[model samples]
Target: MTSAPPTETARNDDQAPPPEQPAGRRAAPSPVWPGLRALAGLLRPQRGRLLAGIALGLLGSLLGLAQPMAAKHVMDSVGQGQPAVGSVVLLSTLVLAGGLLAGLGHYVLDCSAESVVCTARRRLTHRLPRLRVPVIEHTEPGDLIARVTSDTALLRRTAPQAASAAVTGTLITVATVVMMGLLDAVLLCVTLTVVAFVGLVVILVTPHIGRATRHTQEAVGRMGAGLERTLGALRTVKAAGAEQRETAALHRAAEYARRAGVRAAAWEAVSTTLSAVVLQACFLAVLGVGGARVTSGSIGVSTLVAFLLYLFALAPRVGQLVEGVGQLQIGAAAAVRLREAEALEVEEAESTEPDRPEGDGDETAPAPEQAPGSHERHRHPAAVAFQQVHFTYRPGLPPVHRHVSFTVPAGGMTAIVGPSGAGKTTVFALIERFYEPDAGRVLLDGRDVRRWPLARLRAAIGYVEQDPTVLAGTLRDNLTLGAADATDEQIAQVLRLARLDTMTGRLPHGLDTQVGHRGSRLSGGERQRVAIARALLRRPRLLLLDEATSQLDAANEAALRETITDTARRTTVLVVAHRLSTVTTADRILVMEAGRVRARGTHAELMARDSLYAELASTQLIAFR
Candidate 1:
């Protein structure tokens, strides 16, 4: 009995479905100089504030330089028996003012750095969807995620902390060195040599930093992938009682990440400690030489005291330079890994126009055709055909499929049945162009399947895999997914035909009911019916059903069988059958064994001739024969 259509039900009577989540985001690496050049533009908007902040920082450092000098002035005044109250007041005020300026500079630079990172993330996120699918398939999801989450954060720190520190470090180092030179040129010369040696140490270490940091990031990506796999298969792990094995696997992955991180941290610690040691050595040298000069009256006590103050003033910048170099290595390493991911090759686009057959200028020439219909009607040049196809997953391994040849007539129910390793699924994979055949020509509608635009070709057929992936959405949305603009009456007709609407009447929202993640909310039979309804909406000329009704109970199985039989009369249906009950009623059966077609006949005919078919039918058919 045909029921009233779902559209007859009122709108706004059901709960609205959740919107689909946007795809994951990834970070892109910028070319070294070009990325830096783009970064400079981010500073332009706040240039006035930046200049003001930088000026303040310099003033602060200068006042800080004056504090010890002022102490020396007080010391000299006391020795000469003069009042030093005015010198003390001036030094204290300079110290207070410099502190405020330094604080303001840091705030401005930090704000600018955040703005730069935000701009970079927005641009990269926008570019991701436009990238070709093949490139995305080849990349690791965890690696891409790390670029957006971790790598971008690292860059944010680099902009303000590393860049600004290096600048301030430079100005202070130069100013302090000059002040020391005024006191005694020999001591200043020794200090300059130590600073140069520290720079050499940093430069030698920086290159290693980039390589080590990249390895660490890669290890982290691998660990994330392992964790994701374990979580996704949580149910399987629990049922198989393999929790211990899974835990061990994850621990191994985490250990790899730890090793990489340790290597990077080791280099960073050594570089930082060595720089501090270098600065302290300079401090000792300045004190020793200046003390001797003061004793000989070559330099005054006040001059020697001021020189010692200058040495301490230079320390932060020297340390900052060391830290900045270390950060540069990390950024470089991350950039290289990101670049490696981005550089994967994409599948070449199909040509819009194919070359004509040689010596065939006629538009309607009768091409070499297949056998005239014996039991077939309206043969239509074999909807799909495989010629001389030979495929192997890897070189030197035995071929999974060898020299297979067949023609599937358009517009009928054809069933392919086989044992476990008969390569039944590989045939479907080739038809869908998932993996290119090593040596074969797969023809669809009389032309090479690869020649067709990937989107256009896929749209022509409706495919339901063995384990149908049901995305989270409303029951109505799943039915109308392939044809969103389908009319309410047409949608209702399909739902009833697929037997999904029978369950919908029991649902609170009928067709508008929400199916949870992966359609886990729906029973197995309901999910299969929903998938059938979805394919029916497309009105596809070719329907590829892989174990389409395998999950149904006895009552639901009968309903699905009726639906498949009814649809077969109007469209071509190809199904992979594991149960003999399904194929016994099929119009024709192709028995596959060892990747080759062993027999082709109606059920009774195959049972009479083929021992494999006879044995399989008796055991698995459930008396349907």
Candidate 2:
């Protein structure tokens, strides 16, 4: 029979289960221009390539603009009864050169865009592992993944396309209009009036596109989050026969995304189609006015022809202007998402991480160094002391630790045993500094842990969590995750110490065998052994094992018990104990209830003097494995 489990308090010290967020709700949208500014900032690193693309684009537009004049010259030469060969050749050359340059510029801009996304992704991923525990706890992993993937991808199209179109399209459109004015002022006036009306419509429409795109992206994030939620626990869903239920839930999320996408497309379609329509309207107006002028000899036919050619050229450029504005809105919306991700709370000021590149944490662990008030008193195990500690998961909730205090001497097997909700696991969490105590100091070697640099503090401790997580990788990778520079000799030693050497011999590739996702291929006992072996390889000064032997068989449990007792001689071992066997041999034991230590003694001492300890032991709530 199960005893009342611990209050759970903050949940896993390493993996806090976050509260669910409403799918559609989010922070209020930031202003559009800031996101545009962010886009400009992203482009700054690629400025050299950016400038080259801009130059090529402008050159192409210039060539394109000159083609109308070449056509006019061709008409003039033909009317003059000349062969017109030179003018035709010039016109063909301008068209060909313009197309080639535009293509080259587009390719360059796209390459630069890819670089921008890569940088953004690196920056985001770099911050993720460093974010404060509470921040990650509150934020959705799926949504964060969306920002790194789909959100950054939006920048790829919008960054270069919008910037180039704005610069090159504006210049070319203006030049086209000026040339039209020079050809015939009356026709130019008619065209400007029509263009002005369309401009007003486009301005009104663009904000909506941005709003819709923003919503659409958010909906897409929800869909991704939903899918991740399902896949992350696929086995559980399959076991419960809830596949169709999850399918319907995900379908609803996808439907929301689809509806939002249609809204964005509607706004974009309106803006693009109107821009084209206005140009056509201007063309008809110019044609009618120029036709009357030609008949009355106010303007010659070649002049009319060149002016019409200018209008025709202006159509595409005008469309570019509209498209650029739309893409800018979309890009800015994406930028906002990235900006928010960057703003999440971090574990520290990052002063210690200055030398490392973003996403470079895997390459090398930071060399441990002492902080200002940190101690170097021992060549031996680390001592832990929690004094007058107070903690709550969040405000308006009962405190998880209320004036809780404990001290453990260096180099021993210390077990924390308690009923469910008694906050036993919280001891390890506080010692590791995964959370901060509200009212008291947690000391490592007589120095406040807060005074220690995060990297240095974490480096000194090796933690094997309750329900240990094994990432998808080789057995060697999982074992050496914490000890990045661990040698094969040390790995072999830990494997034998954890009773895994025999298991490895049976495996096809031994230590190199794939563990599958979360070590899905491994049994519960094997996973626990892997977790134990990983911690042992770290060679930590303080080793934390939360229920280290809870999943093992009788043989493995007895073997691991011996291993733990032996390791305690070399480094401090603190365990949160549920099984009676785990606590019986501990050098000392703390019996906790309602967030405070109620008893401290050996098993015999507790059994003799404490009613709660005696009751639990008799009932096997401090369970016998």
Candidate 3:
């Protein structure tokens, strides 16, 4: 009979790796321009602040350019044996002012960087919830998380460096060169030759650095995925005694990241060391060539001192220019990854129906609402139907649901039972509209689900997945996740109904006690009950529970099962179960096989009429268990 599927991460990672990762081609890494465009788009919203920062940096660079002139004046005064106090004071003031401007400029840029990261993160969070289920199925959660965390961080840190390099650094380098030429054109030629050669060397080495950085980041993402996979199944790994094997695999991923980092560092080292060495060589060459000019009276001593000071100024500028290019490269790569993640298809705003003509029919025309007080129940309930629905997790794969069709009336318990991989759980997936059917319609309350406002459709139903998920939070937080405005009485009521009142008494902080990561601190049965209580609190018209009672002990399962039967008196309930004992009391039981609904009847009816159901009842499940 049907069982809950394995952990979602394991199923996704094992069966369908992401195209953006190792599978390759479907979402290949974008070329240079697209990444740059993505980076530009991220910065565009912050242009006002970013530009203000750049203006400050430019002003600072101009101030720094004037310092050499101020120093030259001081030198000239000293050489002439005149009072140099005024010149010295000018140089000191320029130094202090330049420092202040630079600090202010960097501060503005950092704030803009932080704002960009914040915006990118918000966009990711918004899109992620609405992404079509298949995209998430194919991709690694850890890698997606890396894009939100690591990639945005890269964008923030490198973006500021790029801005300063492109503007202030280049402008300073050019202005310094102009001043050097004014001092002595002949000596300027020697300095330019050394700088130009080293500049070409750095340029030649930079593309390699960029490629290495991209590889390193990709490796880091893979390592994160591996770690997440392990941590997510920590208990299973420990029970299986496979910790060494898992650790060794993670080590391999880490080693790959380390090697990629080493390659990036080597290229960076070459660029930086060459830049430093060339500056020293330029100083020596200018000293050698300009001394000859001094002997020949081509320039004054003050002019030589000033030219050398300009070269000193050029050192930081040239380094900035080189470093900026590298940061741009790194930022561009991170931007590409971020863009890929953001590009994943998001569910459109499904809460609003399109505007219609005054005479147009109602969107949920003749909505199939339950008759007022028509049943033994005395509350709201949803009607659900599937009509010839077909679906697959991915294209080119065999369909999970083939010509599947079923229906349930309002305010009763309905159960789907079948062997494993028989598409039982997929029924819940379709009802929730997590994945669209390749053919036919899924109707909720007599309206095609696609035609219903997505939010309205979902709000009417509560679904618990095959694997009960309990996020790290307080016990109360987990209980109230679906119903934020739930009153304390409502919480207390469900806690008692789900047999959790006893559990709370043992908790150190009762409802306020922290549920460890994924509720790791809770037993499997405790987590399942917490999930059930959360769903009940939503007060949904339709409640779908897949393997809802799988984790519970026989005693607790029997208790919860009675609660479910009572809940069906007032609301629609659908369950997927492997144990026949749980569903024998259901108002209707569906028998599914090989993606098709083979039969439908109560336990007694099926036992009398169908061999497959009889065989299943007799051998597949213990009838008296």
- Number of the top-ranking candidate, with lDDT as the measure: 2
Worst 10 residues of 1 by lDDT: 1-10
Best by TM-score: 2
Where in model 1 is the C-alpha error above 4 Å? 1-184, 291-310, 349-382, 472-494, 502-517, 608-611, 621-625
TM-score of 2: 0.93
Q: What TM-score would every model get versus the actual structure?
A: 0.73, 0.93, 0.92
lDDT scores for all predictions?
Answer: 0.69, 0.81, 0.80
Q: What tens digits encode model 3's per-residue C-alpha lDDT throughout 549-594?
A: 8888999999999999999988899998767777688999898877
- Give per-residue lDDT, candidate 2, residue 555: 91
Candidate 3, residue 291: Cα displacement in angstroms equals 0.9
Across 371-424, the per-residue lDDT of candidate 1 in tens digits comes to 221122223323677787876544564665677777777666888876655667
Off by over 4 Å in 3: 3-30, 351-378, 620-625
Give the TM-score comparing model 1 with the true structure, all chains together: 0.73
> Across residues 196-303, which tens digit of lDDT does each residue of candidate 2 receive?
987797789988888898888888888888898898889989999999999999999999999999999999999988887888888888899899999999999999
Q: What lDDT is obtained when candidate 2 is compared to the true structure?
A: 0.81
